[model samples]
Target: MSKIDFLVIESDAARAESVVAALQFLGYHPQRGEECLVAEESTHAWRAVYVGGVADAAEAERQFALLGAAAAQVPLLAAADSPWAARLGAAGSPFAQRMATIAFPLRYEALAEAMRGLYARLLGSRRGELRFVGESAPMARVNALIRQVAPFDSSVLVLGESGTGKEMVARTIHECSPRRDKPFVAINCGAIPAELLESELFGHEKGAFTGAISARKGRFELAEGGTLFLDEIGDMSLPMQVKLLRVLQERVFERVGGTRSQRCDVRIIAATHRNLEQAIAEGRFREDLYYRLSVFPLELPALRERLDDLPVLIDEFNQRLARRGLSCVRFGASALQALAGYPWPGNVRELSNLVERLAILYPQGEVRAADLPEKYRGQPQPEETRGAALLAMMDARAPAAAVAPAPAPAHDATLLPEGGIDLKDHLADIEVGLIRQALDATGGVVAHAAKLLRMQRTTLVEKLRKYGMQGSLAA
Candidate 1:
């Protein structure tokens, strides 16, 4: 996960410095002018170009033309008030139509926000081709470990909760290894019955067993010179574990009911969400087998632990659904916040399922917080306070006319003359401002912020979603 590299084409030195500083602060690496024009960075690049009104229109056109097709696909953010903005927006140019614009005067925070929005959009477009989408520190460390371990033929034990992408890691290892061209086979040891497990792992000769009318090749024989992934190895019976351990120790196994011993040239990658050490202590799994399988161990982080990566996961799922002919759906601001706050017990697989469901049900529509399933629409509360929280939420929804008004602002009554205002927008802005202030004051703790706002936690959570301010609370 290198920071996305952006090219700034501002001819004004001060403006260029400002843009570069803003991008740098937002975790992007910024390059300037001629240095960024290289085609290598353009071909396999996460390159975005920002055109902030170069002093000369000819220089601006030249810079824009140099990027070629990259400018049309990669994110292009221009200042709306720039001298050449209208020309860039002119008809018959696909690049201009696709470009996003920030209003001029270049307010630092505004510029940063615009860049952040653009970055997320760019990520959506690029996520389809990625084998994995996380850029979180946890995933980054996992990727580094994968690169380090892929070249070796030693056994690897992947440990993680179900749906945490353990098999995906194993596949990545195989793809990166020298054995990539050979067969990569997978078997779930727990999914098959104990009686059939041995026969499934090692082939039987013709007429070797009760149902063996023909010779059959098992997983190890099928995999040959490549990799074999044994998932849920922790659930394997002790008898089978002993036999598997023998194969690992001797690299050979006699097929069930067959006398001849066969050599295996396969590399092993085992995965289980169960605690094999506990199983070993209980005499359900062999210590020798555990030691042999865990020659190298890797742990995958749960989705909740890396909530920051949800956006990218959503993007990846969106792309997958689109390829299947489902209409694409986008998450509204509040929907994203709601998703970020959920404790994903089933991890990435669960997230993908939800995204797929949304794509099917609401195809092409923006998913708001209210549109999410009830379980995912709000943060889960503790059982003890659930009743009280529900009561408070019910109380907070009394009719507007029935509710008491707050005290007037503590200012001079005649300080200024006021005309009628759009009361709805004015009050909505005030509510959003106060909610943000309370969240910041509480150090991003939603419970404390809700208390500060004199509302039930659930009520406050609803308002946060209503005003698209859930991100301010940080769940």
Candidate 2:
């Protein structure tokens, strides 16, 4: 009656009632159904689905197929005694990796445990889906590696360029892993000073150093039962590498001043822009430490290498900006072509920044090739130049046609005034004036005003809210 938290699909009326009772006992509201026929809206409302009393594995598979995308969005819980549950629980089974199988006749403890696991997994899946944006071959491989290695506690070494989103990849792995509910502590080894780096990683006891007035837990202790992301790890000093190697080997560490050794239960996920293998060869990084951290090395391809994913990445960035109440920007064909040709030396992070910058510059507007920063606009295509030249020649040979004089250049100021005005305020005033004029011309009809201004009605509504003009304007 109140929003359904769990949807139980069981053909057997007695088994369905039993599952519903168990769910209610666990403080969950559940609705029982004979088959998987959840409405589209209900799919989002429900937390998980329980499939039980299936005649055989074939029936279960058929039910699963019937569930469709809902199966991917929500966690699936199956009766352990069911014929398909055995196969579903098997290693490498796609369903087994995501679905939680609870033993029946559904003991409270087992059901609770299964629910807890599925809830954490649901959150992790959502996070992973949102952050991992690209579908390019390189990203597909990277995602596959994350899925394969996340379940295990093997140390992960993510290697990439400075802005290639190595940390994001590490976080995705941690989110997809069993430890998603735990703290994901991160520290940049390269950012901190060498002297302070050891203290930062291992912490210190009271009076360990001049600044240590109180005892503190290090990243190893703080990230217990979770993930500890050590970013830019290749820059760690040789001394620190030896200490880290010892911890990796022994799984124990002592505070900077304390004698008691603390056991670390943290999963190590280290990322670096530098080449650690080269660092090892150069005697900067220890070979043993490198070997320990590189147990499962993952290489992230640079943004330039995955050019096909640029549009998707840009769209993802625009969506993020929109969430922040910023107007989204649309890139034109020429702009996209220019972006594709340009080599993104700064990678995804740079693109994200660029998108935000464009949102601010051209809010709710289309961005042309000329609107882009000079560096990002690559040279014009030779074919385009040739076509233009041919058109010009043809025009010269044809009959002379009187062309109207070009309109005056917009905002024709050639120099800044000695006491410069607030350019943003000036632009805002101009925009407000134009919007008011559009509204007046359209008899205060917002839809007509938006059409006149060549913008979406929603975008215009947002502008009205932003400028506090909604009450003054008619619908």
Candidate 3:
């Protein structure tokens, strides 16, 4: 395996050495530099970047933008004073969108935690092209289908709600298939006008229509030896569906205003959020075309259905925000629980948007339940008793004007007990306690509990097996 590397842009001698030493201890090779030139020298080797030692907010902003351009998609972490973070937050510079800011004098443990999370996020994004991140039963079924069908050249119909990442599923299929090296062209069938959809799908001859001054290759020709993704296929008009069905059947199509048929050596992956079966029953969609498209069907569950993947999804969104130069944010326990309990009607897309919004608004704050919008702050129906307890606590407290919210707890320096304790055993016990709480809160649903603890289902399962706690939850 290749060694992981990091770019350290710091001018503070002691601080720079401290950061480098910590990175080395974590098994990552840290390359140090005073400017952004280091980014250009070893781009691919650096998995992440650390920005420090700026004179003020203005200098930090200018240097961040320069490094951002050099490092493109790599995640960045900045160590700065609280005043600097506050300045950046108020000024609303681009750095607030792309870098995770760690205030000065923080414990090494906190820094390590932040670095690990950022690195994992970057690694996951790099791996996302080939794998979809989820371990729930629904996702497992989808993976199984992909494994079974990827070797064959068959029409795949992917059905899911909008914002459920239909295009990602299509891309995953293409990556898993035999034609992985070839071009994968995607077009939204519903986005284009019905009048021009044909010319877009099938190449247009020179002077084919009013605007056809030059010949052009359509999605099919562009896809050549790989896969063609027809998104929102259910919204495709009947005439266009007929044309597509004929192409699927004959394995060839003629350019618009041209007579000669062109061979199509492309795999078809069509996705739609609409109910095509109902459309067929209503006579709006062709039954023959439905048969042709659904040779193999895959359905992706909505965000609510697969809530177990929320933690990973949030991490993925944070990585995207970091690429844009935003500070990473964390969800408090109450906030995370609230998020998990809420019904995500807009699916993964909505969740991503919300995370990005938080990154922009809060920048570097820990989000609490109260920090969320009104609609999302309320507890779900199943947690009514917990909500009642919270209400009771509120009522028991002093007047609102006399009360103040508690400050976040600070990480204390490591201390040894006079009566020595087994550090490993103590940590193991804490982990067990947290896992038990998660399991109880999730009603012993291992996958849900795994999400609650921000752990992969398989990892949780292994722990459960080791502890002989598998009987606690029915798989």
Candidate 4:
């Protein structure tokens, strides 16, 4: 195997910036240019070292001695920029003169070249860890899809309401893919103003407009050879979509101001909640761009549909809040039931805010049902819960009537220690009966009956599965 690349050390913040720019331009991701150089040197046998300056002359000398003893595995380059360098040079380090003659104030272009040549010896590997940590079925499905798709380079469109963790999914794809070592940059299309959105995506040359300061790399440039996440992409205007479409079809794009076409190999992963088909029909979104982005689409199911994950999400949030020292708070049993019952119109984002608020206000005790937000209190059965909206959508043409209702007695009516039957079984039976009744009412049109049952179609499927009759229902 080829050896690892060299380390680029710098004295101050500005020097670090210059060196980093040079290293990146030269295609080497430089290790920390700070005082941790010796620690890193010990851990990852670097091929070469660039010593800009030591942190403190006296203390640095002591640290340097530790490093000199540890650096037997690699070559060291001590750029002569400090008084300490002169001292080290005089200490009979054999390579001191060869390193010292390279001028201290190296030009940017020259520094970039040198760093490139130094890194050319090593074969690059993917940089860091890629992880996904949710056990929910919806999340598991997303992870599975990401694993399946990560080996290929293609534009991906993630469809979901906000706070559904679309960005996490996008990152998981990039991290597992061949471009894992490359940058995974993200930009919010809706956050920036419309006029500024274009320049932000493609970047602009200096003096392109009134506020132009210096030439800058946009998210695309920063994500070269990697992935770019265009969040809330539906919010981008028609004109910008056209330009983005051009880049997708052809791997070349022009900066906002400069006419020079820069060719880049970057995978694009876009996300949005808006119905782009409707937008395209309305002449707001471009059809070509829609097709390009939707080449691989993944829809994230809403939290309400995955209510079984509520407990998992709450526990995760509790641990996260505890790290911030809001440790004592926990959801009461009733509070949890209340959370599961609510419609969660805002989905996971709403749940997160409520959890944070509970942690802040009632940090040391069980949060009571009363502590729950007013909207969720005193819910009716799911059938009675969702209003009359479903009554208006049914008709006579739909077939597939509900199967014969299993009587309430066949339910898991276990005789309790002090009672004749388990109430849980009784209630589940009632829910099952209600679903069957709704299906019978609608003649089994899932959508129409889902409205009548006052539940999501997916929820009804799960409920049927719990009773071991879901297969018949699906058919």
Better by TM-score, candidate 2 or 1: 2
What are the per-residue Cα lDDT tens digits for candidate 3 across 1-475?
3333577767677888888888787777776654444244224255577777765656555555444444565666777653455554344664443456776664464476466435433443432244676777888888888777877899999999989988877877776777765666789999999999999999899998999998877879878898989999988999898999999999999999899989989999999999998999999899999999899999999889988888888987886666444668777655676788888889999999899887766664456554577677664322232233333334323576655453322332145657765566445444554565566666788887777566899999998766445555755
Please estimate how well model 2 matches the true structure, expressed as its whole-model Cα lDDT: 0.75
How high is the CA lDDT of each candidate model?
Answer: 0.73, 0.75, 0.72, 0.65
lDDT of 1: 0.73
The TM-score measured for candidate 3 stands at: 0.58
Sorted by TM-score (best first), the order is 3, 2, 4, 1
Candidate 2 collision pairs? none
Candidate 3: the clashing residue pairs are: 96-326, 97-325, 97-326, 98-325, 98-326, 99-325
Candidate 2 total steric clashes = 0
After superposition on all C-alphas, the RMSD of every candidate to the true structure, in Å, is 19.5, 14.4, 18.7, 18.0
lDDT-based ranking? 2, 1, 3, 4
Query: How high is each candidate's TM-score?
Result: 0.56, 0.57, 0.58, 0.57
lDDT (10s digit) by residue, model 2, range 72-152: 556778887766667766887766656877765656545765675565454445544535668999988988888889889
lDDT per residue for candidate 4 within 1-475, as digits (tens), equals 2222446555576766766566566655456534453444324444456666667666545544444443443334455465556754675865433333245465553354333322221111222233444677877787788778888997899999877778877877876788865666778998999899878888899999999988876768867887889999999988788888888888888887899999988999999989989999999999889998988999988888788888877876775554333544576555676678887879777887888887767655456454456787555333233322233334445443623332243223234445354456445544554665567566666676677766798887776555544323434
Better of 2 and 4 by TM-score: 2
- Flag regions of model 3 displaced more than 4 Å: 1-130, 380-475
C-alpha lDDT (0 to 100) for residue 168 of candidate 1: 80
